[model samples]
Structures are given as structure tokens and as C-alpha cells.
Target chain A: MHNSSRRGFMGKAFGAVAGVGAVGSLVAMKKTWDPLPSVKAAGFTTLDMSIYPEGKLITEKWRGKPIFILRKTKEMIDSQTESQATRDIVVAGIHYMIAIGLCTHLGCIPAYIPAEKEFHCACHGGQFDWSGQVTKTPPPRGLDIPPFKIEGNKMILGEVGPEFQAMKDSGVTL
Target chain B: MAHFTKATSVKDWLNQRLAVEKIEKVMASEYWIPKNINFLWAMGMILAITFALLLVSGIFLLMYYNPDVNLAFDSVNYTIMREVDFGWLWRHVHGVAASVVFLVIYIHMFTGIYYGSYKKGREMIWLSGMLLFVTFSAEAFSGYMLPWGQMSYWAGMVITNIFSLGGLHMDGLVEWIRGDYVPAQAFLTRFFMLHVFLLPLAIMGLIGLHFAALRIPHVNNQDGEEIDFDAEAKKYLDGDKAGSKVMRFANDFMSKDMMVVGIYLIFFFYLVFYNYGFAMDPVNFDPANGLKTPTHIYPEWYFLWSYEILRPFSINIGLMAFGFAQVIFMLLPWLDRSPNAVPASRRGKFKIWFWLLLVDMIVLTAMGKLPPQGIFSTIGLVAALGFIALWIALPFITMNEKKV
Candidate 1:
């Protein structure tokens, strides 16, 4: 009985030690991202699609901008080609055309309005319709799609939002 | 005449004030303090003393501090590190002491809950304590932003974003609070003023009121025994054995409290001189640019449980749940019960509840730092549910306990 009791006690202690060790390791490993170093990297690289293939998306950092290079999906290209008002749409989701993922009024990410077939400002209520036309007046002009060239299976896109001339003529870069 | 000509010894000077005969007489006199104090009984004075320390040191800070956002960080650094005599020491003391004050306040309130200090005559004290904690937490949060560090900036954004739940346009409110679109110079300045002046003043006044109300009922002693005596004395018309006499404040309470104070001072100095105030994450040291969102935004440790609660649920539920937890705590006196409000008699039940609370708190804290969607969050949800169950069980268990 004494021996059994000793074994029991030892078993419990071992279990506790194991439990603690497991928890410590789990917590240590669970740190998904390191904030300190990223914050310290005073400058970040910005990527432009000019380097990649058509339909390929690459990430580059000019400062902190998240630039993407997506070769137009066949459906997306077809949808934009079909709509005159949205002919300037750079990319299209199944339900809505994205003029530029960037907002026309203020350079914020706009949400696709699937039901309205428009691009809506997630920040403010600025809206653009299927043709990339500014449906809302606060936006001075239609949204501008950054110029991109498709070469074979790859696509190259500029890092800047749009041509200065196009932005001025449209007066939409507000 | 010959003796008078000689210089007085150190002993002679002390002898007159601390005459053994007088000291002996005072020590022998049977003084009545409430005999029924439970563990919860000790925390009230501790908290009060802490609040007083915070107030005095904060006032000293205000004298050297400038409230302008642009100038606030540098000014604080200068005041603590360079400008004033022992300014570094005192500022570090005050900064560290603030963290300690909050830590003590949390423990004190927990003691109150576990021991049922919220019951009977102690209800007002408990309420006042809760109110003090809420105010103190708010002050700490706003003051944190005054440093204009990376953590402060992001912490401000994260907390302010809570107001934007489900299409609520709180931009106006945010701008009003921030004094700009994002946390900017105006907000920092205003927060500095509030932290150094307005909040501390309000806390001091409240502390005074809380203590005054407590004095009227004498410190509640351990167990229900002392409290029962209070009622019996009141009933029998025995003059004030029930805890109405005022002892010499300096000699009786101060001596004991001083020991605690000394120990605390040592610890406080260590943290200030060695650790400095806990550094905000280095990334937050960058200027607050609204364009960049920090990858992870978490509140200070004290607020983690509530923040964790907000993370797992839908926005609407999370918002409601956030306020709900605080409201539940504020209304705790009515929510929980222990027979006659003394812990000794209710130990078995209170112990269970205390352990349950500890578990819940730890689990919630762990959850708060995790991403909202995952197995970890699921575990967090289970723990939260367990917490709710335990909270609801306190009254039921206490009310049904057999008389000792």
C-alpha cells in the first residue's frame, strides 16, 4: 500500500510537470506575428506588377501600400468589356466590377456592392457603379484603374494609383 | 540648574513625547475595534492608502508636467530624468505606483467579492470602491495615450474603434474625444490634463467620501461574530461596544499600515528604477499615422478579460457583452450572497467560487490575446460560459448553506 501511494503521488507530480511544460510551449509558439521588428523597419518595399506574369498576383511594398498584380480573370475581362459605363473597370468580381480597389473620393479600400452592382466606400458612403462611374457626387469623377499590360500568362501593373493626366482630367483623385 | 545646563540627550527628547508610563497606560487600555473583520475587511484601508499615495504623487507630477501633445512626452521625460530634484525617482515612483495601485485595487475588489463585503453595511463601501476602480481605469487608459508612444497610439485606436460597432457613426464622438480625426496633439493634451489634474482630484474627493462613510460603521471585523456583536450591542444599548469609538488614528491604524507602506515603497522603487514604466511596444513609438493599423491591438492586462469577451462573438453581441460584464460587476452586491456577509462562515462555498473566478479570469486573459476565430477562441468561449455559471451559482450556494 505504501509503495502504491508513492507511485500515485509521483504520477500526479509528473502529470503536473508535463501539463505545465505543454502549456508553456504552446503559449510560446502561439505568437503569430512579431510587431517589434516590423515597426522598427523604418522603410518597407512596395511591389508593382511590372515584374510578374499575367493572371499572377505579387505583393510589393512602396512604403506600406499593399500593391497587388492580378491578371484579369476571363469572366472579369469579359464583363468589363461588355459594359460601356464600366469599361474602365480594372477588375470585376462575379457580381460587381472593381474600378480600382482604391476609392475614387479618398484612397481607401471600397467594398463591392453586389446588390447595387456598385463599388461602395467602406470608410464613407462614397459609391461608384458598374462602369466605374462615380455614382456619388462627393467623388469628383469616376474611379481610375491603374494601367496594366498582359504579356502571355503574366501581367504587369504600375505601383502608382493611376496616371497623373487621367487623375487630373477625371478630377477623381480627391 | 546643573542638569538644565547640559545639552538634552536624544533619549531625553524622545522620553518626554514617548514616556513609558503614558505609552504603557495607552497600550493597556482596552480599545474596541470591530472584531468581525474577514479577509475582505483588510482591503478597504489598503485601497484608501493607495489612493492617497496616487493623489499626492500625481499632484507633484502635475506641477512639472505640460499637457501639450507635442510637448507632453518630452516634458515628462525631462521632469523624471533631468529637470527636478529626485524628479526621476519621484516620477518613476508615481508611474510605477499607479500600476501598483490598480493591481491592489483589483485584488481588493476580488477580496470583497469572495468574502461578501458587498452585503449589509458594507454595500456602500463596495459600490464606492467599484466606482473608484472604473474611474481609475479610465484615467490610466487616457493617460496612456499622453505618452504618444506606438503602443499608446494603437491602444487608443483599438479602444475608440469599439464605438464603431454595427454602423454606429461615432466619428463625431471620436473626433470630439480625440480632438482630431485620429489620436492627435489635441487629444494627448486633453488626456494629460485629465490624468494629472481632473481624474486624480475626483478620485481624492471620492476616496474621502468613501472613508467617511466607512468610519460611521467602524471597520467590519472577521466572520459574522463581530458583526453580530455590533447588532447585539445596538440592541442592548451598551454604549458603542458595537464599534463606534474612535481610537488614536496615528497610533492604532497608522503603525500597522506603515509597515505595509514601507514594504510597498521598497517594491515600488525597485520597479521604477529598474524596469521603468512598462514599455509600450516599440512599433507604437512611431507617430500615430491613421493610415497604418497595428497588426494586433490589445488593451492593458486589466481590461483583457472584457476585450477577450468582445473578440469571439458577433459585433452586436460583443458590444452588448462588453457593457454587460461591467454592469454585472457594478451590481455585484445584489448578484452574489454569502450568509451574513462574512467569509469565515462561508468558506467552503466562497472558496469554490474564488477558484472558479480565478480560472475564468486566467482563461479570459489567455483568450484576449488570441485571434477571434479558432480552437483557442472556442476554448475561451467554454471558459466564459463556465464563468457565467459560477457567477450565477454564488447566491444559490450561499443561501442554502447549513448554519455552523
Candidate 2:
């Protein structure tokens, strides 16, 4: 190859190498973007709902996240369970929800925006309706419905409820 | 066109519907940049490169960062620094690139001012750039709070309290924003969202408008001479050719921009690795303590000049002046009444006042570091007045000057 062509080829080669290397290194260095796992394992974790009463939300680290265990108000439950969209997550009669707190988009937990009647992700503007369906996306789907059970008005969460399971077997899908 | 419409390929099918080829040619390939433009034109592209770096590194930092007040400091400074793979690299790069972005923006803004790039039909470009700077500050301020450090906490407090100067209570709004009566989890989390998502999106839209406005008139050279594109284009095939006056954006200007960007990355990395302290304040090493304020609270260095202008006078009057001065500066396009597109070298008072205002800004920046006492206070007061006076006097000076 002539000197000029060889130099041009070498320049292009170096540029391409440097460009790919820079981006590759940056991405390789990034930690996994998954939301921190909830530490409270998927089993029967007992919580007395009496103390939490209606309208209080309690948080526990299940699977390494502070997944919300809400003693939801009767009104909130009435409104939510009335719709089929929330059937999988809402407790059968007790007005409780073991809802996933972490945003599906970037894993940052969202705070309940009271005025908006929705959970708004702080890290990104992903909004979930009261029924947990994503009203605004960038979160591809709604907040995850963590499976739970209620016994004697006390919540046994992160496990399938026997009564709920029987109902599901009868083809009653929420 | 047939190649893009082939039935077997999704990429081709979508590209065909989107008209991707035509868009690329119109936006990039066929766009013409002024050929003789110097290195300073590279400032806009450098600002762009630095912003890209900030976005990438910031995303990586966000992966491991927790925005809870009790955990934010430890999560950012300890666990992310010590546990996460290449956490230190991402953290340092993001922090350093923030300062670099501001530096590039300042240079770009002042370069336009010096060359009168904002004059005439490019008013919208200047306005968008000004608004971009405002959004940039909001973006930076919100990010600063994410670490929950001493300066971040105190600065947030001071700036929020500045709203009280109008005498109406601001505590309610402040508490509403913080999600608490104090800087806490809510504040950190909300700021993280704004910094990472909202501001980035807003600034990109503004930059798109800036670029759109820029392409209309093309870039202004050092002389800031008007180009009658109809006359210039008639010299060659209007659609296909770029003359000596205007270079093609695809290869000629893009190659040069890439070369400058490569060189700038070397310096950027040097600061990220070796002189990283310039990007951070020593006070930020301590976690935020609301019970105690730092002895001397100051803004980041990029804001020092404007902060200095607001300092050393009666709090009420100085604050008013600061707001007024910013508005005046942004309105420079209409305010500067010079008939000449290219300013004359020896335009008497106008030329002298231009350099004078530049010197005043440097002096004010220096004063921002000193205690507002003795000579510095007097200098600050004078600098504030003189800076405003220069702008107020510019139109009169321009009208009196002899045309080149």
C-alpha cells in the first residue's frame, strides 16, 4: 500500500477502535440496572393489620426492597377491587394490598402522589394508577402484584393464599 | 427507496415509513457549515459531547444510587465507591463532566456574545440558549442534592429561603417540594427524578430548537458578516454543492468536529483522574447536617460571577439588581442597535466598554472566593453597578460609533 493510503487506513482503524473501546468500557463498568432485590423472602410473613388500621401503608424489605403492605381504607379497596385490573393483588375481603413499591422502569421506589391518586416514580416520571395499572409508561407494565394471603384479618404476604388459590382454580381470574 | 420497503425486513420497513434516509441527508449530510470557521465553533460540539458523557455516566451512577436521605450519602460515597464495579470511574466521570459542561457552555455563550452571533434573525437561538442555561442550573442543582452532602443541603436551604425576600411565607412550598419540612428522602428522591429524567429531556428539546435555528442562518464567522445564501448558492448547484464560504456538514465539518472532540476527551479524562478535586468542593465530604450551616456557604464556581453580583449590597436591592441584569443580558439582541454586522475594531467607547464588562466579570468571579469585607465589598458593589451600566450604555455607544 502507498504511504498516504496506509496512513488513512491506520487513522480510521484507530478511530474505530477508540470509539468502540470507550463505549464498551463505560457499559461494562455499569452495575446491573435491576431494582434492588427485596430482602424479605417469598413466604408467609405475618403482620397484624389492626395496628396499621385503614389508610396506613407499612413497608418491609421483601426480596431486598421495601415492598409496601398497605392497610388500605375501605373506600380505596372498594374502588380498586371493583375493577378486574387489581383482582390479583387485592386481599379477598380485608381491604389490604401487598403491592410492589419499586418502579418497573428503573427500580426506584415511587411515592404515592395523593393529589393525583397515583404512584409517581421519582427517578423517572412513570405513573401508576390506583389500580396499579401503569397510566403513563416508560414503565412497560403496572406495578407487580405480589402474591399474598389474609388469615384472621392478619396478612400473610408474599405467598399464595389458600382461599385465593381455590378461587383461582375455579377460574375466577381478577 | 425500494431497498427500504422490502417485505422481509422490519428495519427496512420502518426506515421506509420514517423516511430515515431523507431525514439524515437533510439534517446531517446536506447541511453546510462555514468552512473558514475557527476552533471556537467547536465549543457547541464540545458542549454536546460533554452533555453526552454526563448522561451516560449519570445513568450508571443512578443504577447503584439510593435517594433516601438516611441512605443517600452512604450509598453514593461509600457503597457505590467501594462495592460496585467501576463505581469510582462512573462517579468521577459524571462529577467531572458536570463542570466540563458548564465550562463549555460559558465559553460558547461568551464566544457568541463577542462575535455578535445573537444579533439579527438568530434571536430565537440566543433565547433558547439562555433558557437552556436556566434549565442547566436546575439540572445541576437537583443533581447536587442527590449526594445529601453539606454544601448541597445548605445551598438547597439558602436558595429555597431566597424566595422569602418578597415577604410572603415560602415554607409551605418549600416543605411541599422537600416532601418534608426539611431536606430529606422526599427531596432527594424528587430531585433524582428531575435531574435524571425531566431536565435531560427538557434540555434536549431546547438544544434541538437551538440546532434548528442555527441551520437557518448557518454559523456566524469571526467577522459576523451576513451571507446572502441565494447569491452564494447561485455560484454552484444550489442543492448539491457547498462553496468556499460554506462547507458540507457530512464529511468536511463533521470530521473536524470529531478531531476536536477526540482531543478534548484527553483533557477531560486528565481532570477526571488527576485533578478531580476541581470538580468537587471539600465541604461536600461531610454528609448534610441541617442543624448546623457551614461557616461560609457558596455556590459552585460556575455561578460565582452572578452570585458575586448579588453579594455585598443590601440584600433586597442586590437581589433585584441580579434579576434585572439577567433579563437585560438575555435581551441583548434587541438592545444592541449596531448597524454593522461586523463590529469595527476601533469603535471607541463601545469597544472599551465591551472589554470593561469582561474584566468586571473576572473581578467579580475572584471576589466570590474572598470574604465580603474590606476592599472586596467595595469592588463587588462597583462591579455590580458597572456590569449593568455597560449593558445600559451599549446602545448609546453603538449609535454614536462610526460605521466600519
Residue B8 C-alpha lDDT in model 2? 50
Q: Each candidate's root-mean-square deviation in Å?
A: 20.0, 18.9
Candidate 2 docking classification:
incorrect
Residue ranges of candidate 1 with Cα displaced over 4 Å: A1-174, B1-32, B35-42, B77-87, B165-167, B228-250, B277-284, B337-339, B344-350, B370-373
In model 1, what is the error at residue A165, expressed in angstroms? 26
Cα error, candidate 2, residue B334 (Å): 1.3
How accurate locally, in lDDT, is each candidate?
Answer: 0.58, 0.71
Give lDDT tens digits, candidate 1, residues B102-173.
Answer: 777777777666656666777788778777888888888877776566667667755765664433535455
**Top of the candidates by DockQ:** 1
DockQ of 2: 0.01
Worst 10 residues of 1 chain B by lDDT: B27-36
DockQ of each: 0.02, 0.01
